[model samples]
Target: EVTGDERYKDYWRFLHDGGMRPYIQRILDHSNATRGYRIDRLEALAADGIPAILETRTYPKIGAWEQAHEGKPWYTRSGRLEFYRDEPEFRDSGENIVVHREPIDSTFYEPNVIVADPRHPLLRPRRPEDYGADPRDVGGDARQARHVVLTVDQMLSSRHPLAEDGYRHVFHTPKYRHGAHTTAVDTDIVAIWFGPFGDIYREDPRIPFINEMYLDINPLDARELGIEDGDYVYIDADPHDRPFRGWRDNPEWYRVARLMARARYYPGTPRGITRMWHNMYGATWGSVRGSRENPTGLAKSPTTNYQSLFRTGSHQSCTRGWLKPTWMTDTLTVKGLMGQKITRGFVPDVHCPTGAPRESLVRISHAENGGFGGERLWRPARLGVRPTYESERLQKFIAGRFVRRG
Candidate 1:
């Protein structure tokens, strides 16, 4: 759809010729105008904002920090980058230096072994001398000068099980804006990032029903479960009992927020993978088909499957807890906001130093009954109902026996 790079020759654009430095300067200038006013007047304080921003967010490889601390050594004990840190955690972990290790959850095709490269790929600095990655520091274990084993490794080794069902696929929850100008899922607004269309989707008849929820399965996997494309299926996970802040989800790993969605066959999906797009069809809104055959009720305010009782309303219902991925911590010292480490947080909401809602091992079965309705419960109680006419003779007999026809 892109006609040409210079389509709007005069208007600003991120083209091939321009570099990030200029683009960033423009953003810094704008921020200094609007954002810098809180500390002091923008006119007075704006001139100094660019240097502050560069030293903070942008590439600091050769920025103001280099000049500010010209003689002072960096944070390391050696005043240089140390591949083998003298921390007990590093020595204990066996990772004194860098080593190539596989992902914790990787289904083992080969033995889970790692090859250590203690020497620098580019600069082979000698050990006890120059302090580049020393080969002796590469191999880790107790008694060996190798890398320290990490606490994260032990945490990863403790396998967390979700579902016992024979078939649990590698699950990913993808972000599909059922429509634009929405919150977690779809809403009544047809919004672009900026401009007049921000509230436009409210009246547009062409918007698809956004509340209906569905899980994407590979075509080959669909056939194995006897699930045809568009068939309803009940998706669930194993019990997980942990404390979730109760803002978006709950604490239990196995606690299931059950809802039903049609099984959609996604093209090019490999056999052992599944995906569910967020917030679409459910019991309330999108599922209701208009009564008129010809169809004219298009302009009405849009409604998705609202009021999902089990929280199965969105794909994140199954995503719970955390998995620590990376090693070490990044200390970001900020000013004015009381030295807020923007990347780090004490709680889950502000920052989850863990991974986001990505992969899950889940169980899927055919939802034969109409989803979210009491179809099965209502059927079982049908035998208890008796007609009043049939019970009239019994009522009279009981009255005569108890009251003697009074």
Candidate 2:
């Protein structure tokens, strides 16, 4: 509608008619190699709509079946498995071969620190002045001189700014057992199973359990910080260039650029490491206050029924993007099925710039308003009564009333 182009409408109509299946069939018909397997009964081999190969058998196992059975070569310049890469982009970034590189943000080093292995021929050695190390004692042997290593005392005292400011815990977001990659967790049934507070009913005054975020910390770490399980705490990450610039004298300091969550003492978590379930909801306009010019609060106006679940912040408040040079290369390469086509440097779904949310650091402190037995605590409603007919069916099944005899 914005462009007013009729070609886009035509394209949409084309897609709506038969989707990508017709295009895929055309490709199979034209290709000499795949022409033999293009039979009418290909869809019958698999229950799912799309079949990987147009053969009588099920889909082949990834990385194993194609090379072993069909004598197909792997995707590479040599058309086989390769370890060493001579690509200019790979050599420039010192990632030609598999090697461990420290996270860009969550580390003892300063933010955006330049890390390089002295053994790598293309990359330069770390400067002694950059790390505040003595010039004479730095990089004597190339093999021994890898990345700059800092002692615990040095890290806490001088190296890490966050550590010096008492933000010692390394923050990471891992997958939750109840949810499948940010889906189905919003429902009350799923929310009740995880976190310290159970599901919040629709009538509850507090935020719904789906939008409530929680932090998992080691028991020892919690003890050191005088934190107890199920206590409300404010999590503050590096505020330099993150959610905001400077910390102003706002009445609700916790509501600005900081996350509030219930602290869970988990002994299973490693010391100095903290975890939160990934994909928690973010804040809305109603959750935040306006600037001084427009001081009237939207949350207080209540003209709209769109209530924000979050009090202030989000999971991405601490995260930032770190782009790798190699991923942005413009070098042309062979890609696609059977390496039949030459494409640009960027390979779809394979090579791309990605964000590192796991590389984050935070500090936790007890919230002044909320604690054990406080008003902020959520009193979860009990599960709803089961339906009569469903209950009868379950009872009958248990009693073998529906059993079949042959």
Candidate 3:
């Protein structure tokens, strides 16, 4: 509403034209990589018009991006491609330069005393333990480390190891939902793309993959798990909630979030990996859950629809993920320009926090009656809150998509 409406465009225009200019200018001023560059060049190009530049018909590459500094010191903290910073922190942290740390799996085995092939003199065998530290395992902390440590030994261990050890599979979720930006999750758009196929040729926006959410598993793994194609299976994100400081007696610490979805055995899918197309469910009001008759269920928008429980299928619920706050070198500098207030301002998309759920492990199994007792099963919104489903705005969306679908 804010971006499309002209009334709302003024503020946007000011940020792009007024504020963005200075921000870019600041980067250009400080970024030595952008040495010998000026914003005026861009301004001049814009002033003369793009049509004039097009008349030349010659493509020209510009600046440090092209082969770095042709004849000058390239811009950087070191005025060169900085593999190492002169900063003491790099030296203290043992990351003085780019170095390859073996995957945690490599640490599981004793370090080979013999070098590989022995063709390269520089190559040397790795030590099981190094840097005067006892043998350690790289667990939950990809905030970084590498070693074969039982996750039970360390609270922070690698998630991949979990699937390899106890958990049966690693559930990978990618942002595949088309919201206001792509398909734009709205009634008018949904009408055009309600079902999977609009034509027999099988060429339509509503492809089978996009119409609903399903678990993509390898055919081999599917057979092993006793899951047939189109079977509604449960994906249990293990360790979804763990007790604080080893809460062995507390049952709450062992809770899991189970997401139900139809299984699709893809031939090319790796044997152990399961991918759930993310952002598809729980993004809209009536999001699909496990299947048509049984969805993951949903909670009404707490901020908007209080009484209504939306069927926004589950995804994030199945993981112990946390928002990863962006810690850029210098993201937030200035605010409050062109009537855009300061306190309410949002960090730009580039600096926005994201959920790092790679540590969330899951195992697929048959879901009887949705899911297990200790698992979080999606439930429909029960009435009790203000701004219920009776609200004029939400009712219209429901009516347009589900009610008027005759």
lDDT of each: 0.40, 0.55, 0.41
Instruction: Estimate the lDDT of model 1.
Output: 0.40
Give the winner by lDDT.
2
Candidate 2: tens digits of C-alpha lDDT, residues 1-406 = 7899988878667477857666666777777546755444566655557664534233442444666678777556666777776677666555566655555556554433234445555553344455565644411122122234333344344344567788788888766764676542555465455555553442332333333567888867876886656566777777664555454544355464567677766778888888887655555444554311123322221344343334456666666665665666776354653345646577765565675355577778887323323643223211111122135556677679897887
Across 1-406, the per-residue lDDT of candidate 3 in tens digits comes to 6357776766567585756775566666665445445676767877877432321112453535433535454434334555643333233323334433332221222211121233333333222254444444334333132222222223323234455555666567665554432241333245236322122232321222334356778867877876655455766553424212243455332222235555665666676677765544343322222223222222223345321111222455454433322222232322333222332223454333344443345667865321122222211111211122134555766568646534
**Deviation (Å) of 302 in candidate 3:** 10
List TM-score per model, in order.
Answer: 0.41, 0.61, 0.44
Please say which candidate is ahead in TM-score: 2 or 3. 2
Q: What is the lDDT of residue 347 in candidate 3?
A: 47
RMSD of each: 22.6, 10.7, 15.8
Instruction: Give the Å error, residue 202, model 3.
Output: 19
TM-score, cand. 1 vs. native? 0.41
